[model samples]
Target chain A: MFNNPVTSLAHVKTGRLRALAVTTAKRASSLPDVPTAAESGLAGFDVGFWLGALAPAGTPRPIIDRLNAEMVKAVQMSEVLERLGALGVEPIGSTPESFARTIDAEATRWAKVIKDAGVKAD
Target chain B: MTSLRRMRCANDRLGGARVALVAAALFAANVAAQQAYPSRAIKIVVPFAAGGPSDVMARTLAQRLNVAFGQPVVVENRTGAAGAIGAEYAAKSAPDGYTLLLAQVGDTISMSLVPNLPYNFQKDFAPISLVGQTAFILVTHPSVPANNLRELIALAKSKPGALTFGSSGAGAASHLAGELLKGMAGVDILHVPYKGRRLPPLIC
Candidate 1:
């Protein structure tokens, strides 16, 4: 079964489920002992479930900037950091430009994967 | 007759001036409303069901945003159609900084798989800061013999169509992750997709 660390970490920790590997480029901080898929002999096997913020396209730039500033600050807060960290989630408070770039890159990367694998919407 | 024509022209000019004044006043009011952002509740649309990871993350951010802006920041779950419903709702909403979508990687993937989606992911949304990322762990029931990814791949290769992996749903991140693993490992393991948030225990 493939599940995010938030829901599956406890089962993995308690020995109920045997974690084969994390499907991310970096090893999870909470499960440092577990090897990443790439390290486990599948090179370039990076698949992370990333979350980001977005508003409608016509939203003013100033408002977007304000939201970004507050979000970046909030994610870095000690309480937020600790809460996310325990679930093996990495806090990334990136600028809007960088986030847009990530979205573009991910869209391209996953589109090819879906096409190659013949994945259809259900 | 000339005086009557002059009087009509004067009335037309007066009407135009009144129209301009009202337009200016409305524009000013709109600007004032925008400047005082979050004058009312700000909603974050989570495309998934409540108590899911996306919802949890949105609520976490909402709490902080509420405190920072001194206005209510709410998380609205608009779940359905593998997150398309909420995404479309957010996309068509007024771009006044009050409506936002807690977007996930699934949304980007849906662009390729789901055809004729109402809004384009890149064109309809403005990117904001990335919140956080969680790694998906591939786990198996304790009874499986494979201890690592390599062993599991070998096991699947040996018993090609016999082993099956379960996912949260069709076209979900988990399902795609399973597909990626299949493509990378060059194995023929079957994919079993479960519906909704409840995932049955791994049977393979």
Candidate 2:
């Protein structure tokens, strides 16, 4: 449990734990001064706790696009940004294309990592 | 003119009028259907426990979407199997755009970690947008002799398999990240899996 809002919600913000390295390419908005894993000598380490919206595969394109636009608009709202910042989460309003790519790439990368590590699910 | 030809011409003119009327009716119905979309409540399914970031984010977005759609939007938490249960629930749900999933990275992680997952991350769902990303921080106990990634690797190498880290589970992001560190740095640190995410002492 580190600075992930998903894991350290009650701890990270309270400064009970200090960050030695973050697993993103850049510094977290909540902890700007903290260096990234790349900066900390492990180059190309860019894993993040990401979230996205998804619908059933047969969902209409119009509905999918509408949801994407609405999500993008919602995330860009100043209030939303402020709220996410308070929670140590970075607001990303990525398009479906980019989000799909991210999902694929992350899964592929993590798959290889898991295979290499011999990690299994509980 | 032949009787058949006369009837054909007359019916052709009638057919033109009928086609125009039907086309207009269809256009109106299509517009009506489009307008009717989201007339009902919208549900965003969270694949994790309540009070987590995904649940909170979905709730916030649900509030905004409710305001935008002028329909009640709700957040439903379906916790199990590290989010696959909720994802499958959303995947098998009606494709009417009423039910959605607030998916997380764990969904994909489970694809590689969990065998025979209920749904395919890429195939079973249509991607909407990446709501946000949480940056994972690597923190250590004050007593652990490491200040940064390099230092941590060095410390692990100094005592092979002596340094142990805890993750949410065997196939969690934290666990994979630790394994990645070992592969990248060539260090031997044992990975201990926890039932769920917890603070260092509790996890260890």
Candidate 3:
């Protein structure tokens, strides 16, 4: 089913997303569609990734684990998360092994997409 | 009289040679200045539109990096096709550390998003330490009176396929974030695509 506002807001006068829609419309009327400011609350969404930091495919496990431990410690700090959030950044702290798997997976995924799309280096 | 004229002519030729020597010395000094690493200025490429988050971050960071390096670090925006235009330009730049790319998540994701990109992220460039990362949050337009994420989801669920979320574009992170919210919240919000940046601005 589709519950999107551009489609649904016309129907519900009392919906929360609808309420936001109203406020956002009012805000836009006062502001330019694209503001010169680099960071503004007008755009209230965070969308990006912080994948695992990878080394050579065969790098030793000990070093990888140590790096992961350091990253985990850094990301776990409440202050760090808050700062990242303020900048619209999400913090993802995951295991080295897991991160490694994700990196490999993403690499393969993109490679296939490129191949399928007939994308090549220019 | 002939001898005096010859002497004068020789003197003039020697003076001309001295002037040539000084010119050569000045040219050498200028070459020396150019050869000096970061002797004058540095440039950073922000492969995104100006006034966007990444561009702002790059400028801010460039200021700090400039202070650290004792040189002027300038930010140049080369926005197009997500970030391909900037990345391609950065790759073609001098490998000298003076010219660097202030790449972020979008640049990396472009590898997956932009098929058959001309440059390889891993091959053409080096990863300087990551500056920082921005996180995505699920915010509804303030029009919806449901406070917090739960109520928003509940309200959307009550009206399945009746809600919509604006995202930057198809295949963008915001698009995925909306999709992820749909999957996790089990609420279907139609995806409204915007031409530039994130979708939230266009929706409002």
Candidate 4:
């Protein structure tokens, strides 16, 4: 199974790649017409995909700040936003502090999911 | 001479006020250091193989960074260990602003799936920004008899190990999601991981 709608939707948007449900609780902005996983009967299955830019732990705070500011600017660009939207990507551009908190929370969340699923690296 | 007098006056300030002055000076120096830091090429290491989601994202940002910084921003793919090798390399690299990392959710999943990892994400990396998000989509070949999630579960139950699935690789998010589906659905489907696709769940 392709892990994201971008590839799946790209492969065959109409025939084979019908998006039955998205993992988000709400409908995906890119695929607003499609129903959510919960709406499709898989209630509470809200797994999501997120990406971040990170520097080494001791990287200068100013550099991190500059990077974050530029990224925020990039995501807000109309062309970038349009491309990302079409690819089923949501531009977050959140603060470094919040991004750190998100990583912490997500690490914990996926750990539980993998643990409960007894998922082992084959 | 005037600056020296101002420094003396700042030193004369008491307790919290003096501490604030010292902190302000440190912050200015830090900013100055960072401003002049990335005069050379900056590397954004993609832990996954080239052409993957992370790599594409990294490349996009690299282009933007090149324009923003007026320095060539390069994307280096340090693939392997399901992204841990690259992540560890990035973590251990000099804390200088020259090197950055484009970390994906797969890397986070690896934190749980891979034990005794060389780098602790929280400890080793400082997040700059959440670039974007992508959702995992579960798909089946049209030839498969099952049409929907419920039917798929019923079919897998009747067939047991007859259902086989594929993933990008072992320890990849899709593989884990397959395991999760099996556990949640309670059926005996086989998992076949590859740099390919197709995953099965014995849906019960």
Q: Candidates' TM-scores?
A: 0.85, 0.85, 0.52, 0.78
Clashes in each model (backbone N, CA, C under 3 Å)? 0, 0, 35, 6
- Per-candidate DockQ values are 0.70, 0.64, 0.09, 0.51
Order the candidates by lDDT, highest first: 1, 2, 4, 3
Interface RMS deviation of candidate 1: 1.8
Which candidate leads in lDDT? Answer: 1
Output the worst ten-in-a-row residue range by lDDT, candidate 4 chain B. Answer: B195-204
Give lDDT tens digits, candidate 2, residues A1-122.
34464355345456565567788887886667778888988888888888899999987777888888889999889999888887778888898889899999988988899888777667
The per-candidate TM-score of the B chain, in the order shown, comes to: 0.78, 0.79, 0.67, 0.73
- Binned by DockQ into CAPRI classes (incorrect, acceptable, medium, high), candidate 1 is medium
Q: Of the native A-B interface contacts, what share survives in model 1?
A: 0.89
For each candidate, what is the lDDT? Answer: 0.89, 0.81, 0.52, 0.77
Q: Candidate 3's error at A11, in angstroms? A: 23
lDDT of 4 by residue, B16-84 (tens): 697898999998987778879677999999988887778877887888888998999999999887788
Clashing pairs in 1: none
Off by over 4 Å in 2: A1-16, B1-32, B202-204
lDDT of 1 by residue, A1-122 (tens): 88887677888889999998999999988788989999999999888899999999989888899899999999999998887786667989899999999899889978987998888878
TM-score of 4: 0.78
lDDT of 4 by residue, A1-122 (tens): 53567666754467754444566556667666666656656666666677899999898887888889988888888877786777678888999989988889778877887777667786
Q: Candidate 3: lDDT over CA atoms?
A: 0.52
